[model samples]
Every structure is written in C-alpha cells, then in structure tokens.
Target: MVNGTNTSGFGYDSSTHSVIAEPAVWDSYIQVHKEAGKWRNKIFPHYEDLCIIFGKDRAQGNKAKDFAQMEEDANNEEQSEQIEGGFEEQTTENEDSPNIGSKKRKKVDDVIKGITIAANLL
Candidate 1:
C-alpha cells in the first residue's frame, strides 16, 4: 500500500496551514510506517540505482516455498541414509550367522506344538 497523508480525525489548523493529525492517529501511523520499514528492510536487502531490490525475486514468492520443499527432501534423505547406515552396521556386526538366536534350541518348540494342537481343534 502506498503511503498517504494521515487524515483519520484531526483537521487542518488555519494558522499553521498544516494538517494537525490527532495523537492516536499519529501514533498508529508511525507504528504502521515502522512495520513497513521493517518489512522493506527484511525483503529489500540491497539497493541498486536508488531502487530497493528484494533479496530474492519479489514476483516469485514460490521460490521460498520451493526452498522449503528442498529442505524437507534433504532431511528425509538424511534420515533414510541414517537408517540404512544403521542396518549396514548391524549386518556387518553379525555377518557370520545372521540368525544367531535360531542356532540355540529352546522349550519354545513344545509351546508351538501345544498352540498348533489348539488351533487344529478350533
């Protein structure tokens, strides 16, 4: 929005011939201007030929969104790589026999036999 003269209550004084803005209106105006300045400072980081140029293209706000997407993709790739690396480490640690637990026979076979019998009855 273009900056306009404040005219939100106080009228012009005849003696000074200058518009006398109300205190509250003036405060609000100053605050708004301050915020606009902040935004301009953030977006337009550089100056070229007295014209403010945005850090990125003003027209392509989509570029910021694309950057966010790329960041998310990078994060996902990092997580996948971490998981694959962990699996690789585990495999290397147990390369000789993958199922080391299966070599040790236990009482679980009797339990499985009982479960199978029960399942057949059902």
Candidate 2:
C-alpha cells in the first residue's frame, strides 16, 4: 500500500479490506499473475487442478458450467496453437487423409492408388 506518493508503506482501508499498493507494486502483482497463469495452463492438464489453482471458491462456483467453459477454452487454445504452429506434424498437402500420422497417410495413399488403377482399367 502507498500513501501520498511515498514509496514505502502499507496502508489498509478498514471498510474495503483491501491494501492500497504503490503503482509499481500493483503492476508487479499484475505481471506475476500473468506469468503464473501461463505456468498454470501448462502444469494443470485437468479441471480439478485448474480449480485448485484458481481457488476453492472457483471450484464450487457453478462447477458444471465453469469447468465446462474452462475445458472448452483449454481445448480451443491448444487447437489454435496447433493450427498456427503446424503441430499436426503428420499432416500434408494431401486432403484425402483423415488422420495426421505416417501410418494413416500410407493407408490413404494405398487406397488412392487402387482407385486410380480401377479408374484406368474402366
């Protein structure tokens, strides 16, 4: 908390139950939370862990709805990352393949080849 531009001190408002922090300290807190959010996303793969990180109140807050939203956000974020960075590593320019993996591509290619041969014979 800060008082009258003084750099050092903690001030509490009894009514608000919140500390008034210096601008610099407040900014630091914001930055720390942003970084922690990144780590939380990476470390917590499940809804329970996310709730634990967010707080118990969050875990209990309309859990069916809130947890579903969290999972949706996580999935959308992962898919967006994969779309942007080409994490679908096994995918190719070919559109016929349904799966993104070497084995799947091989199977698709064989099917295409057989179809081509049948078309030529006809």
Off by over 4 Å in 1: 1-65, 95-122
Give the Cα error of residue 47 in candidate 2, in Å.
19
lDDT of 1 by residue, 34-90 (tens): 753333212222223223434334456554555457656756776686567556656
Best by TM-score: 1
| lDDT of candidates 1 onward, in order | 0.50, 0.51
Candidate 2 deviant stretches above 4 angstroms:
1-65, 87-122
Residue-pair clash count for candidate 1: 0
Per-model TM values vs. the true structure: 0.27, 0.23
RMSD of each: 19.8, 19.0
Please give the lDDT score at residue 91 for candidate 2.
42
